[model samples]
Target: MNILVTGGAGFIGSHLCDLLLLQGHSITVVDNLLLGRKENISHLLNRDDFSFMKEDLLNLPVLKHIFENGRFDMVYHLAANSDIQKGSKDPGVDYDLTFNTTFNVLQCMKEYDVKKLFFASTSAIYGETCDRLTENYGPLRPVSNYGAGKLASEAFISAFSSAYHIQTWIARFPNVVGERFTHGVIYDFIHKLQANPEILTVLGNGEQIKPYLYVKDLVEGIQFICEKACERFNVYNLGSDSRTKVKEIAAMIIEEMGLDARIEYTGGDRGWVGDVPEFKYDLSKINELGWCAKHDSNASVRLAIQKALGK
Candidate 1:
């Protein structure tokens, strides 16, 4: 199968590309090098079956040309604005990066008659909910601009899939952590420690709890769901069974980096204005499909820290 991964040069996308290539599928990755780092997929650049295009999804002409010429069997739309914090600050940031990017991808897909789409949605779309999020949980009230953008994109994907007869898989991800990870709590914690080993300034009150998934577990889950959940449109919550707190993650990072830092809270329950205080996902939907996350939230954080520290 010829597969097109929109953000194939990023953390999760690159890992997915590696697995796809290993399974003898030809893969082409299109990334803008914004949040995605080229080094993430650097090893696959020399492979005959793997191709990289440093192009933004917003470029419709280039995207249309690539789609028309390549004739991709499936499209894994992994491209998006990764910085949730930034989105909280400026709503327009996510609108352009996440929502517009998906619109462009869908338009190109329609033009090229591409029928299959695998989208990367987020748990943030659930908003500041206290209940465990399910696939059917709705009237999705997203708190952050990032979440709003993703929800809008999901709606577009569903509409496009229904109208064009495209098979679509939308997986709502938790905090995904592991190798090649560019942002998030783990990444932020490590960088802060590196700069000041003695003072670890944590945002919020440090009680914000959320489920997280290891990158490998996430990719594997995606592969499994995509293979088994063959329907007109499918939505699954991809995450670990358990949850973890912000302070717990800080402690983990501090221990992993061997730093005895003074933990200082910036003072607030939420990390940012749009940040959800606490949320966990119910993975029974996917678990019923004979798939489960191998690593718990704590283990995922630990492994990501180890990889980040090069240990």
Candidate 2:
């Protein structure tokens, strides 16, 4: 199969590309290097089966040109603004990079007669819900521009699927961590400690708990759901079974880095605006499909720290 992955040079997407190539599929990666680093997919540039395009998904004409030449069978949409606060600062970023990218991708796919797509969705679409979030659980209100944009993308995906017979797999992921991480709590903590090892300042009150899924585990879920779940539209919550607190993550990072830093709280329920301080994913749907995350949140945190620290 020939696969086209938007944002395939980024953290999770690059991992997806690796798995695809290992499975004997030829892949063409289109990434503008916004959140994606060239280094992430640099290792694949030399291969015959792998190709990388330094292009933005928001540019529809160029995307269309690529689609015409590629003859792609499957499309994986992962391009989006990774930062909530950054998008909150400028809603246009989320609009162009997150939502518009999906819209444009769907348009190109429709024009090119591509039938299958895999979307990298997020749990943030659930908002600050108290209940364990299921694929069917919704009032689907996202507080942040980032989540709002992704939710909007999912809506278009559903529309495109129904209006045109496109098969789609949507995985709502938790906070993913591991190697090649561009930004997130663990990455931020590592950089902060490197700057000042004496004091590690935490964003919120340190009680925010959310599941952390390893990136590898996530891509495996993608592969599993991609192969097994046959439907016009399939959605699943891909995450760890257990939850870990932010303070606990901080403590683990502190211990792993051998830092004597004092953990300081900024005193808030969440790290920033548009942040969901607490949430849980009900993986019952995927579990019933015979797919589950091997690492719990705590183990994911520690393993991610080790990979980040290169220990």
Candidate 3:
């Protein structure tokens, strides 16, 4: 099967591309290299079965041209704005990169008669919820622009799947961490420590808890669900069974980097305005399908830290 991964040069997408290639599938990666780094997929650049196109997804004409010719069997829409905080400052950031990216991809896919699509969604769409979120969690009121944009994309994906007969898989994800990571808590923590080894400033109350999953686990879960879940439009939550705190992650990073830095608190519950300080996942849906994350939240954080530190 021929596959098209939208953000194939990013951390998670690159890993997915690697697995797809190993499984004897031809992979075509289209990443504008905004949130995605070219180095992540550099090793596969020379492969005959793997092709990388440095093009933005917003360009409908170019996207149409590519889709008309490549003849993709499936599309993993992994492209999105990585920085959630940016959306709080400028709403257009998420509108252009997050929502618009998915919108254009669907249009081209519909035009080209692409049958299957796998959308990369986030836990942020659930908003500030106290309950462990399921895929069917009601009245999704996303606080962050990133979440809102993702929700909008999901809506369109569903609409397109129903109208055009496209088989769609939407996986709401947790804090995905691993090698070649460019954004999120672990990446930010390491970069901060590198800049100033003496003092580490943590935002929020340092008690913000959320699930963290290894990128490998996330990719594997998606693969399993795709093979097993048969529906016109499938939505599932992909995450670790457990959860982790902000301060816990800071401590992990400090220990991994061997830093003797003082931890300072910014005195708030959320790291940012739209930040959901606490959220959990009920993985019963995917677990019922006989798939569970191998690494717990703590293990995932530890592994991501080690990889980030090059240890």
Best by TM-score: 2
Model 2 residue 304 CA deviation (Å) reads: 0.3
In the range 215-271, model 2's lDDT, one tens digit per residue, is 899899999999999999999999988999999999999999988899999998999
Q: Which predicted model would earn the best lDDT?
A: 2
Residue-level error in angstroms, candidate 2, position 80? 0.6
Backbone clash count, each prediction separately:
0, 0, 0
lDDT of each: 0.91, 0.94, 0.92
> Model 1: residues >4 Å from true position, as ranges?
none
TM-score of each model, paired residue for residue: 0.98, 0.99, 0.98
Which has the better lDDT: candidate 1, or candidate 2?
A: 2
Off by over 4 Å in 2: none
Q: Write the per-residue lDDT of candidate 1 for residues 184-295, one digit (tens) a residue.
A: 8998999999999999999999999988889999999998989999789999999988999999999999988887899999998987778898998888999999999999
Q: How do the residues 108-152 of candidate 3 rate in per-residue lDDT, one tens digit apiece?
A: 998889999999999989999899898899899999999999999
Q: How many backbone clashes does candidate 3 have?
A: 0
Candidate 1 global CA lDDT score: 0.91
Looking at model 2, residue 79 earns an lDDT score of 91
- All models, RMSD in angstroms: 0.9, 0.6, 0.8
TM-score of 1: 0.98
Check candidate 1 and list the clashing pairs: none
